[model samples]
Target chain A: AQTVTQSQPEMSVQEAETVTLSCTYDTSESDYYLFWYKQPPSRQMILVIRQEAYKQQNATENRFSVNFQKAAKSFSLKISDSQLGDAAMYFCAYRNSRTFGNKLVFGAGTILRVKS
Target chain B: NAGVTQTPKFRVLKTGQSMTLLCAQDMNHEYMYWYRQDPGMGLRLIHYSVGEGTTAKGEVPDGYNVSRLKKQNFLLGLESAAPSQTSVYFCASEGTGQETQYFGPGTRLLVL
Candidate 1:
């Protein structure tokens, strides 16, 4: 069984500043996928960024990026130039690449507050 | 196009009451999943379907049942509601070749 952990329950960042949310996971599988999802006040889950375990290079999507350290079993999300819209509950997820059914294992979540 | 939609945006049920939540996707996805979200718990999988008529139990399948008679429709049923079952329910679907799952708006369920 894979388990994702988000140590920080709450985080705040100044507008236009950068923020990093920490995430760690325990999985025996060598190949897997890591994802960060954002849930705004609307409560809609949206994909922020994703990283493939096999790729040594981190994944970057516009302002959202991931620092994936496979050896340390750590995958952290970084939001650059943070805006008010970035304020939400962020969740880290994991999925095994070997399985055809892609069931995601998610962390408790971190509440991000972007201050003006 | 509506990616994924869940019927009955909000539902309130009493103990021992029964109800079903419907989920439909228009993306022609082969996999559908049901999950419950609590205050501190991000999301826990309740049930999932790999294909039409093939359903499987997920991490938290107790007190819940799911059916996928049609490829695009997935139904989650609670035979006997309990206070513990009060939580927001979300439906997700993924294509056969896609790794990312698309989520619905979610259904707010309150079991009194």
Candidate 2:
């Protein structure tokens, strides 16, 4: 079984500043995928970013990027120039590549607060 | 397009009551899933269907039953509700397998 861990239960960042949310996972499989999802007060889960284990280069999506260290089983998300809208509960997820399973193993989640 | 939608945004059931939660998707996705989100426990899969007329148990399926009669609809039923089964239930659908899943707003259920 794969497990994702988000050590920080709460995090705060000043507006226009950068903040990194830590995420780590445990999986015996060599090939897999890592994802970060954000849930606002609306409780709608939205995919923020994803990283493929085979890719050595980190994935970047506009202001959202990940520091993926496969060897260390770490995949952290970095939000550059954070905004008020970025405030939400962030969850890290894990998936197996071959199974194509939609069943994502998620972390407990971290509440991100954006200060103006 | 509605993407994914779960009927009865909120529901309340008695300990021995039986009810069904409907999930409909318009994305033409072949795979659909049901998950329960509990506080501090993340989300756990209850059941999933790969295609129409096919359903399978997921991580947590002991108390729930699911049906995928049409390609666009998936239904989850609790034969007898319990307090422990109360939680926010979410429905998700993806393409063949490894694609990013699009989720529904979720249904908040309370059992007393």
Candidate 3:
């Protein structure tokens, strides 16, 4: 079974600064997909970004980018130019590309606080 | 399109009581999933449907039963509620190979 781990339970970043949330996974599959999800206080789950294991280049989405290292099985999310609106619970998820249902195995989560 | 929607935004039930959570997607997605979220425990898959008339158990499907009689709707049922089952339930759907699953707003279930 594949598992994702987010070691940091909480992280804080000052406004306009950058913060990196660490994530590691245990997967034997060579090809898979990783994602970062943000859950706000309203309980809405939003997709922050994604990375494909086969892609060497990290994925970047505006202020959100990922550092995906396949050999190390590490996928970390970096939020730059952080804003107060970035406060939320961030989750790291793993999925098998060949598997059915696209079921996601998620980490416990990291609570991100953006300080103004 | 409403994307994904779960019926009964919130509900409180007692032990032994039974209820069904309805999840509907207007995107005509081919797959649907039911998951439970608890504090400190991101989310665990309870059940999933590959398509209409096809349902399968997920990581934590023991106490949950699901039916997908319609392509656009999936229903999860708890025959008898338990306090341990008290958690926020989420429903998600995606087209085959889409790589991204759209989640519902979630149903807050409280069992006492």
Candidate 4:
């Protein structure tokens, strides 16, 4: 079984600043995928970014990027030029290979607050 | 496109009552999943379907039943709702391989 852990329960960042959310996982499988999802007050979960375990390079999507250390089993999300709209619950997820398509094991989300 | 949609956005049920939540997707996805989100506890997979008429148990399938009579729709039923079952439910669909999952807006259920 794979377990994802988000140590921070809540985080706050000043507007226009940068913030990093930490995530770690336990998985014995070598081939997998890591993902970051955002859940706003609207209760809609949206994908923010993704990283393939085989790729040594980190994944970046506009202002959202990840620091993936496969050896350490760590995948952290970084948000740059953070805005008020970035305030949401951020989740770190892990998915095994093809046998399970997108069945993600998510961490207890980190509630992000953007302060003006 | 409406993407993924779950019916009855909000519902309140008394203990022992039974209800089914419906999830539908228009993306022609072959895989559908049911998950429950609780405060402090991340999303837990309840059940999933590989395709039409094929339902499989996930991490937490207790007290929950699911059916995918049609490819576009997956229904999750709770027989005898309990207070422990009170949580927000999210339905997701995805294509084969490692494609990203598209999630529904979610259904908020409160068991009294």
Candidate 5:
């Protein structure tokens, strides 16, 4: 079974600054996908970004980017020019590519606080 | 279009009570999933369906049941609710080969 871990339960970043949220996973399969999802106080889950294990280049979306290290089994999310809207609970997820199973395994989550 | 919608955005159930939570998607997606979110637990899959009339158990299916009679709708049921079942439930759907799974607003369930 694959499991994702977000060691930091809470993270704080000043507005307009950059912050990195750590995420690590345990999976024996070489082919897999990693994702970061954000949940605001509204409790709405939003997909921030995703990275494919086979892709060496990290994935970027607007101000959100990922640092995917396959060999180290680490996938972290970096938010640049952080805004107050970035405050939320961030979750890391994993999915296997071999079975093409749509099921996702998620981490406990990290609460991100953006200070003005 | 309403990507995914869940019925009774908020629900309260007493132990031994039975209720069904509805999830409808207008994207005509072939895959639908049910998950519950709790404090200290990000989200856990409860059930999923590949297509109409096909339902499968997920990680935490012990206390839940699901049905997919129509391609656009998936129903999750709780036969005998418990306090442990109190949590927010989310419904998600994705295309056959699509990587992104669209999520619903979510239903908050409180069982006493």
Candidate 6:
């Protein structure tokens, strides 16, 4: 079984600043995928960024990037130039690529607050 | 196109009452999943379907039943509601060869 952990329950960042949310997971599978999802007050889940375990390079999507350390079993999400819209509950998820169902295992979550 | 939609955005039920939540997707996805979200718990998988008529239990399948008779539709049933079952339920679907799972708005259920 795979488990994802987000140590921080609440985080706050000033507008236009940068913020980093930490995440760690335990999995024995060599081939897997890591993802960051955002949920706003609207209650809609949105994909922020994703990283493949096999890829040594981190994944970057515009202002959102990920720091993936496979050896340490750590995957952290970084948001640059943070805005009010970035205030949401962020979740880290893991999925085994080799599995037939490809079910996602998610972390408890980190509540992000953007201060103006 | 409607990616994924869940019927009855909100509902309240008394203990021992039964109800079903419907989920539909228009992306021609091959997989569908049901999950429940609590205050501190991010989300727990309840049940999932690999294909039409093929359903499997997930991490938290107790007190929940699901049916995937049609490829695009998946229904989650609560045979006997309980206060513990009060939470937001979400439905997701993934297309073939895609790792991303599209989520629906979600259904908020409160069991009194």
For each candidate in the order shown, give its overall lDDT on alpha carbons. 0.95, 0.93, 0.94, 0.95, 0.93, 0.95
Q: Over the stretch A3-112, how does candidate 4's per-residue lDDT look in tens digits? A: 99999999999999999999999999999999999999998999999999999999999999999999999999999999999999999999987585558999999999
Q: Model 2, stretches more than 4 Å misplaced? A: none
Looking at candidate 3, what is the lDDT of residue A32? 92
DockQ of each: 0.81, 0.74, 0.85, 0.78, 0.72, 0.76
Candidate 5, residue B27: how far the Cα is off, in Å? 0.9
Against the true structure, what is each candidate's TM-score?
0.99, 0.97, 0.99, 0.98, 0.98, 0.99
Candidate 4 docking class = medium
Candidate 2 lDDT over A1-116, as tens digits, reads: 89999999999999999999999999999988899999999989999998889999999999999999998999999999999999999999998887755589999999999999
Which digits, one per residue and each the tens of the lDDT, describe model 2 over residues B1-112? Answer: 9889999899999998999999999989999999999998788999999899999999999989999999999999999999999999999999875468889999999999
Docking class of 1: high
Interface RMSD of 5: 1.2
Candidates ranked by DockQ: 3, 1, 4, 6, 2, 5
Against the true structure, what is model 2's DockQ?
0.74
Model 5: residue A99 alpha-carbon error in angstroms: 2.4
TM-score of chain B of 2: 0.97
Q: Summarize candidate 1's per-residue lDDT along B9-112 as a digit string, tens digits.
A: 99999999999999999999999999999999889999999999999999999999999999999999999999999999999999997888999999999999
What range of 10 consecutive residues in model 6 chain A has the weakest lDDT sum? Answer: A95-104
Q: Clash totals for all models, in order?
A: 0, 0, 0, 0, 0, 0
Q: Chain B of model 4: TM-score?
A: 0.98
Please, what are the lDDT tens digits per residue for candidate 3 over residues B1-112? 8999999999999999999999999998999999999989989999999999999989999878999999999999999999999999999999977988889999999999
Pairs of residues at least 3 apart in sequence or in different chains that clash in candidate 1: none
| Candidate 2 vs 5: which has more DockQ | 2
Better of 1 and 5 by lDDT: 1
- Per residue, candidate 6 scores C-alpha lDDT tens digits across A6-26 of 999999999999999999999
Clashing pairs in 2: none
lDDT of 6 by residue, B72-96 (tens): 9999999999999999999999998
